[model samples]
Target: MKFEIIQPGSYAMIKATLTQGEAIKAESGAMVAMHPNLDVEGKVDGGMFGALKRAVLTGESLFFQTLKANRGAGEVFIAPAVPGDVTILELNGANHFFLQKQSFLASDDAIAIEAVSQGFFKGLLSGEGMFIQKATGKGSLAISSFGSIYKISLAPGQQYIVDNSHLVAWAGTVTYDVQKASSGWFSSVTSGEGLVCKVNGPGDVWFQSRNPGAFGSWIRQFIPSKG
Candidate 1:
């Protein structure tokens, strides 16, 4: 698949062209436009139960739509529901990623999507929730982010702290933990900063320039609550 990221930052979209017999699987309803001759089929991504677990745990679509250029060649336009940026990454053998829930937009059929349990403390306090999305295998994966995406390639024993709201994904090759943003409880409360993620690596970490949760909080004040 060939891809071009249009509208690079906020309100981003992807324009992809596929060769004959090539296929891409995307979150259901991710298609904004496509060629008339393309074959688009909706099917359970992993398996019926696997799809259910991913939906219930990670908030991803239960079914994925496979787009194929069966007739000859085709093109598709894809965009996430959020007004954010999108990135297409190529995965190598067994190169897995621990992605924020619902960050995945599309990928080649070679990718395997699963729900990963983040455990109790990290799950509840971290912005990523208890169960997160994991993508494995070798293929091209498209990920969407709240704003611009930033990357940090870590050296051995390099550690970085990030506000959970700003994180998009990290290599499974890194070791990480989620904890309070401040050293003390009082500071954590007064700072208005919530839990954070600490990643130690020889791999890479990706972050978003904006925080959707913080943006929501600001917008929520103006939104009238239900009676």
Candidate 2:
């Protein structure tokens, strides 16, 4: 299956095409447009949602969904139940809804919480932590990185260390610890643990390519360089 992210920033959308046997899950009214030959289904549950159950689609089911925040909710995350060719569309205004097939869980069991705000860098970091907790099964999620989106694998018996600045999202089942990276004596004296996030394996990790440091570098281009 192939995927393309159409918009990124406070609001994001992904446009994807599904070949035969591809599927994706969506909410009750999230479809902006879909293929003519695609089959659609509705979810019948309302339970606290994990990652996979959040989105759902059957084979070759063409559907589109939105992942924008509510009017006052600030930001929102759309985890459809079905997995397949998925596309994201940017919606206008604050209030928007879509039709989705709810067959996985009971409506009462579906997970619902106030949307998150992607306004600040720190807010994104916290969102990463929360997104992982909502992950289900062995599937890895592709999140938006500054330059591009990257994948994080959650393999057993292995550990991954990442800079907090670079982390986009992770699996909720994985445990994390704030550890210091060992630099030389002088380096260690000044930089402690380098502020790295040591993550246990059996889960995936996502990182952002461009960071605050990179942004600074880009902004510095206009400054006069002195030898």
Candidate 3:
């Protein structure tokens, strides 16, 4: 299977070419176009218990759509739910990363997506909820973000501060500490910088330029809401 990331930011698409019998598991409603020869089916990823874990903990829907090239070679197109950039990650031995909520787009069958708890403070104050998606096994995976994504590399004992809302994914080799952005609580609220994450990295961290939560809050003033 071969894949191309069409467009880089704002709006991106994943265009994949699959040889016979190649299959890709994708998020529901993400498929934009596909070849007729490919067979499409909806699946509850993992089993019943595993599906429950993903849905309840990770904020991801239990269902996923599978596209299988049953006939000859075929093409498939998939896009994210929002306007953003798309990133393709090749998974091999020792591949494991902390996936941001709702960021997973697609992957090969060999990959496993699970909801793993990240403990109390990270669960409560990290902007991301309790359980983040943990991707493992061997396969290719695609992730999406609401804005341009940047990769920050870290050496042992080095530290980086990231706004909680801007974090997308990170390598598991790193350690993270969450705290208020400012030492003074009054300054924290007034400065428009809230909680931030102190990532003690020996690995990489992927962050987004835009904060969707803050964007929605800013635009909601003009949009009508239920009383």
Candidate 4:
């Protein structure tokens, strides 16, 4: 199977080419187009219990769309729910990644996505909730962001501060803690940063240029009140 990202920046989409019997799995409703020869099915990847956990804990769909070129070679087009950038990461079975909710787009059939707990405080303060999406196994995983995605490479023991809302995904080797953006809560709120993650690495972290939360707030200002 081969994956190509089209329209790289905003409004990005993925075009995946698969050989006979090869398959790819994507987030529900991600399919934009596909060849007639390809077959698509909805599957509860890790079974009913796992699906329920993913849905209840992480806010992901209960089922995934599995597309296969069973009859012959074919291509499928997949896109994210919102306008943004898309990126692909190749996993070799030796590493895994943790993704923010709704960041997952698609991945090879071999990749496995699950909802993993990131602890109560970390999840609550990080703005990613208590359960985060974890991708594992060997395959290509596609992730989407609300805006352009930026990669930050951190050396061992190096630390960086990131606004909680800007996080996309991070390598398994990276660790982070939720903290106030400034020394005091009032200052933090006044600074417009509020909570931030102090990420420590020996790994890479991906962040979106735009914050969906901030964008939603901006949009709300223009919406007329019902009263």
Candidate 5:
């Protein structure tokens, strides 16, 4: 199978080309279009129990859409629910990724996506909740962002501070601590950056240019309130 990110940057989508009998699994409702030769089916990956775990833990869709080139080779277009950028991560057997809620778009059938615990304190303080989606195995995994996605590569022992809200995904090898953005709570709040993740990395980190929470807050003011 071959994957290409179409219309990169804001308003991005994925165009996947599959060989005969090849299949791709995507978040439910992500398929925008497909060739006539392609067949689509809804499936609960890893069964009902796995689906439940993914939905209840990470807020992902309970079902996945599997598109196959059953009839022959074909192309399928998959898109995210929001208008933003889309990119593909190539996961070898040795590497994995932890994706933010709803960042997953599509992946080759060889990849496995699971909901994993991030520990109690990190879960609560990291702003990604108790569980995040982990992608493993060998395949191409497509991830979406609320805005443009930028990648930061860190050398071993290098550290960087990132606002929690801007994170899209990070390499599993990276370690981070969630803490106040400033030395003091009052200064942190006043600085407009409350909690930030101090990332110690030997890997890459992907961040979205826009924060969904901040965007929501900005739009809320324009919405007429109930009198």
Candidate 6:
């Protein structure tokens, strides 16, 4: 299968192309525009404001959207994200085809994972887990990041401990566990590996440029909170 990313690091539309019989997994609802002939489906749980929240928060231009094609090809996926902040992911096989970066959040009114997962049948299983959207065989995807992306790959018999503050994304097949750092929080905090997210086996891992909670602290210092 062949894939390409047309635009890098822009809030504007990003495009990709894919070949048949290939697969890509991502967070759903990243499409801003595409071919009219393509078959599409958007899945999300049936609940009060569940679908609406995804449309508003996840940075998806639309609520729980998808596209499919049996014989048609050469489709385009656009990022309809707001001008300042965008969240989208485009993948082809195990590689990232495209990504857009947006600024950090200024408030705690974050989007819920379960609402975003509604775009796919999987719906968010955990209140704190990440959301996923995937494509099987021949398609391009677009994603957004708050800053530049980082990568880590794990080998067989090896394990990785990543701070949730730095984690961006990882391969679908890999397993993740929240564990105590080998050298303790002090070591990790000082060494940039604090209280880790342990990952195993041949797959990629991503890390964010900054932490929201950490950022929040910085924001709070300027303005005291009420008890």
Backbone clashes per model, in order?
0, 57, 0, 0, 0, 14
lDDT of 6 by residue, 1-227 (tens): 22234444434445534343222222354555555545545545224465455445544323344344435564645453332223333344444211111221111011122322322221232112334432222233333444455667777657876665455455555666665565576775677545665667667666556565566677789896687
Predict model 2's lDDT versus the native: 0.39
How big is the positional error of residue 119 in model 2, measured in Å on the Cα after superposition? 20
Residue 104's lDDT in candidate 1: 87
Say which candidate scores most in lDDT. 4
In candidate 1, stretches whose alpha carbon ends up further than 4 angstroms from where it belongs are none
* Model 1 TM-score (2 dp): 0.95
Measured with C-alpha atoms, the lDDT of residue 80 in candidate 6 is: 37
Which pairs in model 1 have colliding backbones? none
User: In what order do the candidates fall by lDDT, top score first?
Assistant: 4, 5, 3, 1, 6, 2
lDDT by residue (64-142, candidate 4, tens digit) is 9999998999999999999999999889899999999789999999898899999988977898788999999999999
Using lDDT as the measure, name the better of candidate 1 and candidate 6: 1
Better of 1 and 2 by lDDT: 1
RMSD in Å for all candidates: 1.4, 13.8, 1.4, 1.0, 1.0, 9.4
lDDT of 3 by residue, 1-227 (tens): 77789988889999988999999889989999999989889888898888889989887888889999999889899999998898887777685888888789988877888889999888889987888988888878888998888889999999999998788888878879998889998998787887899999798888888999989988989998777
Worst 10 residues of 2 by lDDT: 99-108
**TM-score for each of the candidates:** 0.95, 0.40, 0.95, 0.97, 0.97, 0.49
Candidate 1 residue lDDT tens string, 1-227:
88788888888998889999989998899999999769889989889999999999887778999999999898999999888889877789868898889688888887998999988988876787789888899878889998888889999899999887687888888877887789997897788875788989978888898888888988999988898
- Candidate 5 TM-score versus the reference: 0.97
The CA lDDT at 194 in model 2 is 50
- Give the least accurate 10-residue stretch of model 4, judged by summed lDDT: 120-129
Residue range with the least summed lDDT across 10 consecutive positions in model 3: 88-97
Q: On lDDT, who's better, 1 or 5?
A: 5
lDDT of each residue in 1-227, candidate 5, tens digit only: 99998999889999999999999999999999999999999989978998899999988888999999999999999999998999889899999999987799999987988999989998888777889899999989999999999989999999999898788899999888999999999999999999999988899999888988889999999999899
